[model samples]
Target: MVSDVLLGELAALAVLSPAAAFAALGAYLLLLRTPSERVVSRAVLSALSVSLAASLAIWGSAVAAPYAFVPVKLGHWFATRSYAFELVLLVDRLSATMMVLVSLIALTVGRFSVAYLHREPGFARFFLLLALFSTGMLALVSAGTVDLLFAGWELVGATSVLLVAFFHEREAPPRAAVRVYITYRLCDVGLLGGAVLMHDLAHSSQWGEVFGGAPWPGAAASLGPGAATALALCLFLAAMGKSAQFPLGSWLPRAMEGPTPSSALFYGAISVHAGVYLMLRVAPLLQRSPAASAVIACVGAATAVYGTTVGRVQADVKSALAHATMTQVGLMFVEIGLGLYWLALVHLFAHACLRCLQMLRAPSALRDAQEIRAAHAGEPLPPLGLAARVLPAALVRRAYWLALDRFHLEALQERLVAAPLMRLGRVLDRLERRWVAALSGWPERAAVEPGEPDAHAPGAPERAMAFEPAASDRKGART
Candidate 1:
């Protein structure tokens, strides 16, 4: 949907192209993907690069207006009940900033993935997820509703899970992917419930409609403050899950098992920022709930302090980046909590770009440092040895150790999620055996084959077959 507006067309490109390119790339790579190569991955990377440029142009253009502006629309059929309000690519100040941040991060990480995942097994798969993530990020900014925005939000989670387990042969990658999924699912539930509440109250799902004072169909013109606040809390809970805020905050640190490109793209930038994006998207509605806003602020502040402290303890390059992402995200929450939505957008934008770069570069930087240490054993690399001015090494070390433990959330997961699953699994196994036995017949028994010896068998080798000539040969001989 190109428009007379130069900015709108660009926004359309950002919203639509990445998904299309990735889908095409995915198709091409289906025949070509192997451990040795991933054809056309580069093209998807280039698409994201172009998208990043477009995103920035739009951001710069839209930043002039603080409230919503830059309108463009496209419609798609999502299902029978609801027709897609596809793209109303509005780049009000908040969305503009988010667009720039997401595109930049997607572009940088796309570039990094090219080299880092070259000749790696999941190259095409990685690009597919990455491209989809890029598209979702852009589309999310373009979304004008809780529904459309959620559609985009879901793609981010789906793609992130695949990216997290990109190196599935390893033990850790699978575990990390599962954990990310579990947390994301929980978050989605809250988000969906809140969306229902919003629709019930506002009569329409569109952000403009709900916050702009449209009531739900057949509903009253006025909603109770308590109801609005409840909905706000529900949305905030979703934000906490997606953003890695307290309690739900621990998943990001363990998500480093994926390829570094994913570490850069999903965890470091767009994926982690999804929560903040949601929070900012509903800023108008959330503003009505002072209780919700205070909670958001409290969680964000706590996460910032906790993440920074824990980040001090991380020795791994990716782990450090994960912690950094959490710390910055927490700061963004602070911005949202404090009513400085636009300023938070700036932090989200700036931090996404910087963190992606930092994450993309970290592996090489650490390698170079290691090389230096090897080449000059006794000498200090002055910068590497310096501790943060605000926090000393001792405290950092202590915090790092605790952070490395992720405050034992893994153990808590076993109690809350895993142990129950294990018990359920045993029940399933029992059910399976009973069902299978009940479901089976003689065919199944025959398929199992008789382990028992035949009655004719007597622990002796069977007699060799008697040699016999063909009947025609015998007749010919007789004649």
Candidate 2:
């Protein structure tokens, strides 16, 4: 309809607002202009406000039309004989609602950061990452093509890692950042592979072609059960990492190394729900594959139990909340797996708002605990019922220890995944060195001093300094 054209322009405006903010802040930082905290905060909030307004308008239009699916064309980025890429944004109830939610939360978090991070050294940097995430999330929610979605997905992942390592001066933040990055890289292969398969099977990456374009929730998937199963499994792998399910769940608590505000926004609210959103968006394709749906349900149930158990044993408030988030998100995933689409969406939105508030008020946790204690006159509360009471004492102790160690999931990942890759890397490094030596027609140990020895030398450190002046002649050379 012609009215949908107006809605399309509005959708474009919504996506562009946060992008503009990112460009503005990026320009200021790159130019070495010391931005005032107030100025940066105002600029970001203003952009978010504009984006929020546009998203509301889009939602209004979608409601009026009821079942309309509008696509706003931003032109093709490239084309070839067999492949093409375009920037297209879809407007439906699902996407419009998501845009509204993302903008609203981003605005709230942006405002909170201004006061919370006042005069901190990396104040500007924090805002920059926030703006980047806002832009990416908005784009991802609205993307109508696999190519566009992948672009937005990568942007969000990059910002997540950077924010995790915001306190670069600290040792733990960088290590946590590395872990997050590695997990993302490994899990992202699913998304990358899914996109390729979409092109190969559908011959086009557009939502209309890929999912038969019936306007979400009602859309029929174009793929057969077999192809759909393969695609869905690939996407499930991506969702597992993003949602922190099972073996991939260890990184969620560790991500708390950044500032509290970031922990609130990224893990507590938006980033953690990205995987669930992905599942909801592709629900139609999932319907074509019973196997994929079963896997999703099983994983979600397992994650819920895992999160709840680990949360009980966490020593710190943030980590406890992180596990709690995982628990709730797992429930949402289960809802989606059971074909309860609207319920899952509502769960995602409500959980996000609630978790944001809890994370922001986390610092006051001690004060709140004291108030409760005083109210109760220092008496401990009665124990809540649990299965532990029925178990033997030794078995209870073992369960407690297992829960405390987060079931050793991180250790399992390192041994099964990281250790093997590291060993392979070292082997390849040796082979590469041999190849280079062969190509250059030089012996591998030629650089070592006669008495010093090579890399394989015994009883002494390998003095294999490359092209260094002889140690005996160093004094004369200096003279």
Candidate 3:
């Protein structure tokens, strides 16, 4: 067996490498020092490469030994009267495998971006965010406590929104970023709520304490059914928002407004799969709650069907690919619900790699299509299989229309959820405005009686009479 100290060092390196790179690049950019594109790319890739090596070594040692997981604690971050936070990191089969994938994909994406965005404005900014994302993803995968995971989760979300707004000069990118940010905030409630419940139920935020100290993929859950159900539901809400399940799915396609490299890394590879990884990590909790598992299954199935229908009718390649990614991620969710934990992990890794490749090559799609047509002597390609071959003509037509409209899911969301929230927001704004006006004395001016003469009005009798008393009093005092 490897020494515990060696393993701890390796784990620390795996988490810190990308963070160090992020810090260095961010400092340089903030100081307004222009860094060469090659230097930026190399720095980011080198850090990720180191992280990948450390993660692989850890994974190899764990496999050689009898332990299913290895954990390390750097130090305590802070301590409260009731709760103490620690800077802990863990590596198991799951996290190690994901680390390898994340580093490799990031390296590829970073390399691609160095050229794809050559001489473009914000080139340094792009690498900075990419490095930040790498750090966040690694931290999240290895986090030993819900509190730690939440911190990593937030970092990933922030970088994602920023990447979506990479083209800040464009109107669409900012709008898309805002939409995604709103969705993230709404969905984050679940993660925060779940973390609170976990602390209350287990008396600790550590994964080991919460799950009875068992290794992942085989946790002996300690939380009761009730607690587990509530926690899982909260997490599911978070997952739906992050993974773009069903009604929240519109933002995924709109997120294509960013550069291709960002698009590939985020939606195709890392960010979109974060929620799935979270669920897999907490599989034991879901296993304990039948109600939560049922909800997960139902939602996964609905999202998968929804993604397929919408993907079929998307006019643009990127949008179509986004929906397709949502479909596969939904299947992964189903696998988790069915207790096929390892299968879900495998699916996530495989799908992420494949989708990233497809998205990266999307810009050349027209050229590829032309080549294919030429090879086929300009003949039209045959249709792939149809789902409604035996259905009546009218029914098929109706289904096609529904698919074209993405089943009206976006409209439903705006009407049922967004509209009510927007109205509530306006009402709150109005109330706040009135409160401010009252505090600033505007309300008193607005409340002036119409019959009362204006104090400053020219030739007003009331104004003259009001000043005459004061003037006479001053004169009497002087005399």
Candidate 4:
């Protein structure tokens, strides 16, 4: 449904601003030589400002009076006789909330990035990726179809990967990023599979019928029961992986390798909470799946407790923040699990604001405040009074231990995912070199050099990339 007040004018402007900004961004990027990071970063903030204004105008128009939004049909794809895809934008209550959240986060983080990435080597790359990420998120949140959601999902994942590996010189960032994309691949697998399954359920995935009330003869009634439960389960697995819940949660702490602002943008908001937005997008299906919802709750609870305990122990500011994000995300999942979908949205909104502020300001403020207090007093305050100042001493003691050990998840991952995978990989490497090589006479080329130079090898044309496993390591992968 569309707005009812100056609906045409508001919708027209909202649609135009983002499209115009994107086109301008693409054109300038194509022609430009070496753009200044400051200039580009400012441009990001400017675009965000404009987008926010445009979204507010549009929201002002969402009157209860009957209305509908017809998104510009940019393009389409056909998978089969029954399965067709298209890039059609849709603006409804759901899409609008996302627009607001994404715009707000982009503006805040975009501004923060200016100072954080300033004079850094990858500064330009950082801005470009950030801009692209925001663009994709805006599109995804405002989209009308599953295909559009997938496009936006890919965009978010791409931006996150770039940011995660922002410090490519280090082993940790790159390794963490690799693990990050592995989960992304898992997400794509589910989304693609779900799309196929959905088609069989409803003859079409068009925006007009899927979410509209009067059911399409055969759509799965509720994601809560039976076959619906299966779809819900798949969706849950995908969301868990993307949101960094337990089994796939390790990538996040390692994800701290990016610049502080990138970490702030991702872990603090935007990409990290993307799964929540996605779940909301399918609230109807989700509301039905009690068993699946139970799973979500369990995972959220597990991740929350684990993340909190670990976050408290972390000695480094960034790592502590990362685990804290895990804890809050778990809490967010609690809202989702409780079927307080609206509250989940509210929690996501408020929590993002508070956490980002705390992360960006807390580290130095503690030392500064304590030093000032100590100097003014010229003597230490009583332990009891000091304990009452902020948190209880017991809690602080707990946090100290939790943050330091990372709640032992590090050890768990090494044993379960990484160590086992490495051992199997070595065995597979030997097998491939011996028996497999005997069958196929092609000589193995080293991975460091990708291939014999092809036409696009020198300056490759950018294309939509799926989540693929990392092959060669720039810093980590101690082979």
**In order, how many clashes per candidate?**
5, 0, 0, 10
Write model 3 residue lDDT over 1-479, tens digit each, in one string: 66778988987898889899999988887887879988988998899889889888877877776455666788888988876888887777777788788888888899888889999889888988888898888888888888888998999999999998888886778778887899999999999999998888888777766775565686637778998899999988998999998768878988888899999999999889999988988888988987888888888888899898778877788988999999999998888889999899989999999999999999888788789889989788876647667778898789889987778776787779988997897677667766776899776443333345554467767564664322211110000
Q: Which candidate is the best by TM-score?
A: 2
RMSD of 2: 6.9
Please give the lDDT score for candidate 4. Answer: 0.68
Clashing pairs in 2: none
Candidate 2: deviation at residue 422, Å? 0.6
Which of the two candidates, 1 or 4, achieves a greater TM-score against the reference?
A: 4
Q: Give the alpha carbon lDDT tens digit for every residue of 178-227 in model 4.
A: 87888688666877776666666655565555545422111335322675
Tens digit of lDDT per residue, candidate 2, span 1-479? Answer: 33867888888888888889889889988987869998888888899999999988888777777787877888988988866688999998889889988988999999999999999999988888888899899999999888898888898899999998988897778788888898999999999999998888888888866776576686548789999989888988888998898879888888888888998888888888889988988888888888898889889999999999889887778888999999999898888889888999989999999999999998988788789889998789766748577879898788789998789887787779888998898677767766777778876644443344466656345355543554321110000
Off by over 4 Å in 4: 1-32, 63-82, 214-224, 366-403, 419-479
Against the correct fold, how does model 1 do in TM-score? 0.76
Question: Model 2, stretches more than 4 Å misplaced?
Answer: 390-392, 443-479
Local error of candidate 3 at residue 332 (angstroms): 0.5
TM per prediction: 0.76, 0.92, 0.90, 0.77
The candidate scoring highest on lDDT is 2
What residue pairs clash in candidate 3, if any at all?
Answer: none
